[model samples]
Target: MIHVVFNEPDVTVINQAIELDENLKGDVVLIRDDYAVGPIQNLYLGEGREARKQWWSAVLAGGDYDGKADSGEVDDYKTVAELVGTMRRNPDEIIWIWAAQNKHDVSGYYWLLHFMKEFQGRVFILYLNNLPFINEKGQLFYPTWLSTIPPKEFLKAKKLARPITLSEFEVDPDEWIRLANEGKQVRILEGGKKLSQYGEEYYDEELKKFITGDWQKASKVINQFLSKARQTTGDAYLLWRLKKIVSGEGYDVQGEMKAMKDFEVKQKVGQPA
Candidate 1:
């Protein structure tokens, strides 16, 4: 079974594919993030306006089982786990849906990145560009003074790498900041702290102190950023360094664990949560 994400711009295409395919195997877990503004915004704002209030659900609100949410407000569906339970009871195929126009969808992706750890199927992304090509009326353009051309600074933007397990890289945060500043990459393998060369057991213990222990979400965001970085730099080393930083934070060193862990500690940095 395949898990497809029909993120916005390409929703119509995804729906069309579903209609054309008489009998496609696997289930579809449709995830409509709060960022999915309806027809009005689509007609007016191409990429100018942020998704409406509903868009915050992935980052703030909870998930909703009913597609027909009568409450008028969105349930912040922050993690795939929230949706996974709903799909568990359904026999139909599952596919996670989000919209590209809404940056909030990235938050959903962050959630899905960690979901891979607990989820049993393969995950994939599809670029749906149904809207116009260029944004003519943006508030600001790319800062040419600091412009980093893609092909030279890195490679292409669209390349898929197999999800790397979080257990590979082993190092301290002090070391991690050092590596990140140096432009190196790390890709850690999957394993527990006891197996790690770095002594990170204390870090894990500290992580448990939070009310919402979301290390998985944290790792997912870092990986998402690193994966994109690796694609840009075309540097295997950069990816390798990321592995170290992610693995060292130390918890469940598996898929999605990085993201969840990162989520917990991010807010608490420099202050008590």
Candidate 2:
């Protein structure tokens, strides 16, 4: 069996869980792209994928992860293609896709399942949506990220795995295709397999709330927004948006724009500190 996950931290926790339960042992595949925050139009095609890569280049330019967008490190298309090849070569093999209740994971699920129809029965999903689990403190709570759940609790999560249904295999891919054609840059989970699309600037207004007339380190503003906002994105993405905010009216900027720490930003002089 192959265990597939979306994020890096999840790989660590899943590995720990495997150590505790030999039955859960499998090669773990981490899909490195965050499908929730980039262009999806014709994503399966070479030209469309290149367009999204170029867009990422712009979003990541001058940030700490500069050039990462073009790097082979973030290639999900290649990962999925290899997974498909593996499944084709060994018909007896099975795949388990693990996802938590968050835009990042669910978006990945949508993108992944679209290509998994031929292996319907062989593909299983363990979606932790609205499911409660015991944390390290022994307190029960719903987790938005898989990495937040105690490694021992993964044994319990294992029971939730079920083969991807015929209905889902039919309906879900259509939904993903629709989302791709819509050509939006951001996706938000509405609930259970449902996603709503939004412009790339969806978080800009909320991000600006942290900026005031007093200039603050760009890193500080991004860190605070990630901590305080109900909805948040990666620091790199936020820093990109903050730079856009600085370039437009209503924000004052100083210092180099090479990276988050290299810059400072604030509300324009008369905007109130």
Winning model by TM-score: 2
Candidate 1 vs. true structure, TM-score: 0.28
Model 1 Cα lDDT, one tens digit per residue, 91-160:
4534433223222343234334434434334333432222222123433223111111121111111232
Model 1 residue runs over 4 Å out of place are 1-9, 23-30, 34-73, 76-82, 86-104, 127-273
| lDDT for each residue of candidate 2 in 1-273, tens digit (9 for 90 to 100) | 899999899999999999999999899999988889989888878998899899889999989999998778888888999999999999999999999999999989988987788998999999999999998888989999999999999999999999999999988878889998888888888888789999999998898889977879999999999999998877888888888888987787889987889988888767754
RMSD of 1: 19.2
TM-score for each of the candidates: 0.28, 0.97
